[model samples]
Target: MTVNIDKLTITTPAATSSTNLVALELSGAQAIERFPQYVTVLSDGSVKLTAPTKGASSKSTHRTRCEWSEPTNWTLASAADHWNRQRMTVTKVNSAQKVVISQIHVRGDDSPPVKVFWNKGNITMGFRTKYNQTTPVNSTVLKGVPLGAEFTVSIHATSKGVVTVEAKCNGVSGSSGALQLDATWGTRLFEFHGGVYNQVDYTNSTPAADGSICVISDLSLSHS
Candidate 1:
């Protein structure tokens, strides 16, 4: 008898002009309509994202981010569990302020269950429980990640609202211990977000000169 094993492979589809692109604003009445020039999808399946000083809305000034959501409008309440992973590199940072690399958030909640950020030339991952909250209740998980370096980031959440974060940089790896979720989070829906989200606020007289550029080669998600 003879047996053979089959090989498996996965590929990213080429992006086109009509790709479903979405943007989120921390505060504003108008929704971002058009895809900005700063975002580009390369032929090699890598996405280049640049956060400019001026974002979509003028009512509030902060870094803008675009995320890929399946079905264009799925919410957190739509699923019981969530998982996401990505391989990315930071190419440029205009300032020392923290810039969000990715996040797992619920609809209408200002704060996300997990967020990965680059701050002062280091990587900081945090978990937040409360809804509409700005700060993470837990401490940073991984730090000291070098800029311009390639890294992997992941997030997982159970149906019970237990959350965890995994990260690897320069062959060093770590994970965030299980974080209990706030009761409010379970009442809403969630989504995965990636790109550059600057944490600094802009002023009228002096607009934010801070911006960041990131290249994401791989991004995956699953929910049940």
Candidate 2:
């Protein structure tokens, strides 16, 4: 009945490494609670996540994300179905008006199989059919979504690696249909990540006040 984040690890935009710039990470309740400005539990139990456009990012990547990653990784062959369901409201966005809201991430790969984004006023789905695909195929699944509005997104993968993604907002809905994953992904382990991921990369002159922020009011994950 409630969103549980006690076991999730939060990757904050806080600067960590001095050399190649990577953000600090916090795990569990005590650790995550220390970074309230980026991730915090609201009075109603919703989890708020923030990532500024001008924030520290991984040395290899250009953007930043105040995201919560599910610690447990599951394989496609390990279960009949694995799913992540999250309901969130985006309160702020970067100058691009785009942010990744939820995603299915591989254990070691930079490319995720599924990325559901809140782009402008449209709910877009970007998918990677191949494990190492450099770019994902993009499609608009739902529309009419506005800033500060509540929406729910769900993504699931079958044992055969068939992925399905859907979103609903203000009674409007959209789906990614059925996306078939190639065999290249069969050997990889995956997990779910949700929250605000800024689409823009920060530079020296980027304003600290500009960022992407969202609140996850409900969340759940399952494997069976």
Candidate 3:
């Protein structure tokens, strides 16, 4: 049997605005067979959540959802040797703007081609688009990757005749990018997006008894 105790105190009005300040206490016998137990507080002040269980060597985790208002702008930074997937977007647009995203990957799979897109949604096959008159803007393709290596994907677009952009992760057929080029709004962008399909093999045509693994991460979005 395993047992542990954990407590949390929320100290903001916005954190408890939605829910009625419930003190969650989870106590159980074992980790693999334990369920989350809930408790409530009736005071007008802060709420304290406590959990105490029998035995030892038990692993317990806690998480809380929160919401707050910012001053229309905020800066976010990620440390080295960190991996997190994200999609960036700016609600307002301005001139001479550029969205620069950079990350230092400590250790990750680099053999497969990681596809990137200019906007939201999953990677779509058999898609193409034209940027400007200089050349027919087509789907951008990330070249081969050396296994157990580090690299970066950068895009520089301007409001000056820049049309569309697309990126596909582990793609081999057709192209990936802007689904449509006739849309308005001169918003420049860059993003890292991906999806997963369970398969026995990445390039095998025959069905197998198991499924494959796919993970897409590190997405940044902005406009210039």
Candidate 4:
């Protein structure tokens, strides 16, 4: 059995260099690489991730985030069931009141099959139907999710590469139905991520308090 939290790394809003962002790796010796301010594991086994809107970020991207990612990689056909399920509460939001909470990231680029967002009080998602789809199709998954209220979000995909995502807030539920993936995604390696990723780009004058924060009460990842 694998401990879900033990198999991941935290990608912070801190920059590594002029061209890259830092990844606080959690492993053997790299366990020492963690930063409490950005990624904190509470005594109750929950995790708190913070991303200041004006913090350091990659040169290529304008936003910032503090997200936990599965260290290893896998293709869509790697397992019959590949999923990321998390119980999270957004305690804070950026100036734009929008932030990405989960994603299905493709290994070599910014392109991803899924980008789940907490837009204001609505749970929205962007689905990229094909590998080369420049822009994902966006839709609202759920609405009226209040800040600081716990909610569950799940993104699942099977060996066939068909994806499904859903959200539950205050006993209300919404789903993405079934998002079909193209053959171009067959050989692409992917990973699951969840946490506070600020969607709005930060500028030098942006207030430090203009940030996003999320507390994850439970997270479960499985592939079979």
Q: How many clashing pairs per prediction, in order?
A: 3, 0, 8, 0
TM-score of 3: 0.23
Instruction: Give the candidate number with the greatest TM-score.
Output: 2
Candidate 4 Cα lDDT to native? 0.84
In angstroms, give how far residue 176 of model 2 lies from its true place.
Answer: 0.7
Better of 2 and 4 by TM-score: 2
> On residues 12-85, what C-alpha lDDT tens digit does candidate 1 reach at each position?
11122244222333211111212334555566757666775444422233445433433333445566877877
Supply candidate 1's per-residue lDDT for 136.
72
Give residue 183's lDDT in candidate 4 (0 to 100). 90
Candidate lDDT (C-alpha), each: 0.60, 0.87, 0.22, 0.84
| TM-score to native of every candidate shown | 0.73, 0.95, 0.23, 0.91
Model 1 regions more than 4 Å off: 1-36, 58-61, 66-80, 204-209
Which residue ranges in model 3 land beyond 4 Å of their true spot?
A: 1-127, 130-142, 146-150, 154-192, 195-217
What's the ranking of the predictions by TM-score, best on top?
2, 4, 1, 3
Candidate with better TM-score, 1 vs 4 = 4
Model 2: ten consecutive residues of lowest lDDT = 24-33
lDDT of candidate 3 over 110-197, digit per residue (tens): 2111223222222222221332223333233344322212223432223342222333233332233323333221232222222211
Clashing pairs in 1: 76-189, 76-190, 77-189
lDDT for predicted candidate 2 compared with the true structure: 0.87
Task: Write candidate 2's Cα lDDT for 26-71 as tens digits.
Answer: 6848445677888778889888888888877877877888888888
lDDT accuracy of residue 26 in candidate 1 = 22
